[model samples]
Target: MSELSLKVLAAGSLRAVWQPLMTSFTLQSGIEVDTRFGPAGLLRESIEQGERPDLFASANIAHPQRLKALGLASRVEVFTRNRLCLTARKELLAAQPSWLALLGNRALKVGTSTPLADPSGDYTWQLFDTLERHHAGLGEYLQQSSLKLVGGPASQSVPNGELAAAWLIRGGQCDLFVGYASYARRLRLCKDLAVIDIPENYNIQADYAFAQCYEAANPLSDFLLSTAAQEILFREGFARNL
Candidate 1:
């Protein structure tokens, strides 16, 4: 029997959830799965640069849509959803401050992924914009003051497989980080981090999408949206499609 293999490029936020699912998939189908995880935009850039992968999964719909427009992939499909959260050291909540008070505190350091290079950062900026409508100049203040800790040109040197947001908070590099709620949930379990909920009005939904780059049928893509896959995603904190 000839060996079957697949190359998959996926977003970093899917790291923890994808492994077990893929392992199950491989065991059942006898297909080898090779995954390269990173920021979705960066992965898209690589695809544009001719890094061909059988599948491309992104944290946002925009990246896959762009690839589809360019004829590099098939139609984009929403696989799962996620939302942003504010993660910080547990000690920061000792005073039990409100989300707004903590975010507006100038003395505390804030961290976010790089806009354009990572969807999480763009969503965070959108949240800032919503804040600006209620409190003038708040958006601009966060854009200027918040540190671009990961998922940008500066993060090129950061090792792969490391969760940038969690790492930054764990290393004392930032007092707070705006990242995926799913990621924050995972980090809170094993680390000294706390997950803070953003107001619903200011929150953004992260719709994860994927498409096959080649013309062949992709079982993995179909499997991702299947009941088994969605169950895992939901358990891992991803929102299910209605």
Candidate 2:
């Protein structure tokens, strides 16, 4: 039997989880997987420009829908959910961090996936906006500050989970890195970094979705939405449905 080779363009936050998966999938099906990691938006742009890939998985369902609308993708399906989490140096959390505590610090510095390039960032922006409505004065500081947080998070694509965690543990730089709870958990950075839950009223849930591109040549695209794929996502801390 001939081995299948598929290209999987996935979210930047998935670096930790996706690493150990490709080889295992290949061993099971004799499929050779080529993975490209990036902010979800960048990946969508690549697909639009005709970089043929067998499968597309995004941290948000909207991108897959955009691809489907562009006729570059088909069989789009939502298979997972993720929520925002805050990463802080262990000492910071030990101080008893809270939503109110975030702004009071005066020392609080924050980082998130790039909103222009990633959905997680976009959601963070909405989170801030909702916070502003409730707190009023607090959002003013963000507006006046350099952060000027317009639409969302950032996407330095921090190399890997360990490095991102290191950023927090070492402190002095971005004091908080807000992103997928799963990534924060995977890094175990929360062991030293704290997770400030976004209040349910303001917090947003991320719906992850996947689709087969029109130019794809294999069935792995279909396999991605199967019960098997849901199992993998579920095990990884992503809810199978929103």
Candidate 3:
């Protein structure tokens, strides 16, 4: 198989947890692994266009499900899980702010990935939907708040990495970054950032899935589903489907 070079398309949030293992995968297996990381939807679109990726790993389960149902990727495997959280600059955390506090703070700017292009953004919409069900004022709050302090507007590309939501806060551009707590867990480089574990009511479970693409010609696709690969994957923040 021409010495197996696996092209993996995954979420940018995975950079920290996946790099170490991918390095190990390369060294031990002598397989060249090339990765493209970004919002989940964008990556999937790339694969859909016949990008010839060997394996597709995503932060959300829905996209893989869609691909499986559409016959784009075969042998879908549920690999791991994750969830979202709110991140803000440590200086702004005051006596445990609530979602109400998050929406009401006029001085604070809130940013999220684009719902149409990023799953994280979609989760934020779901959170807002929950808020709207009870806090009808929240719908107005979002409209007003979006107009009041956005850096233009919320988008799929949040200036940088998916977790750059912290950057939005640290840079004095925003107050709260709606993002993944586990994804934001390891960015020691971001100073003075504090995280709030999203309440159960606001939480959305993320199940990561991997599928072997039909056009993928790499043997590493099979290897990635192997016990050895899964062990590395487990350490990289994914739980088994079962």
RMSD for all candidates, in order, please.
Answer: 2.2, 3.6, 3.9
Candidate maximizing TM-score = 1
**Comparison by lDDT, 1 against 2, better one:** 1
Residue 6, model 3: Cα distance from true site in angstroms: 1.2
For residues 219-240, write the lDDT of model 3, one tens digit per residue. 5555555677667656655554
**CA lDDT of every candidate:** 0.83, 0.66, 0.66
Candidate 3, superposed: residue stretches over 4 Å from native: 1-3, 143-163, 187-191, 214-242
Question: Please, what is the TM-score per model?
Answer: 0.92, 0.82, 0.79
Task: Summarize candidate 1's per-residue lDDT along 1-242 as a digit string, tens digits.
Answer: 12488888999888889988898778767788889888888999999999888889999999999999998998689999999989877877887567787888888899998899988888889888888998888778998899988878667445555666667877877899998988766676755777888878888999999978864437788788888888889898898865
**Descending-TM-score candidate ranking:** 1, 2, 3
| Backbone clashes in model 1 | 0
CA lDDT, candidate 2, residue 104: 45
Model 3, position 108, has a per-residue lDDT of: 73
- Candidate no. 2 TM-score: 0.82
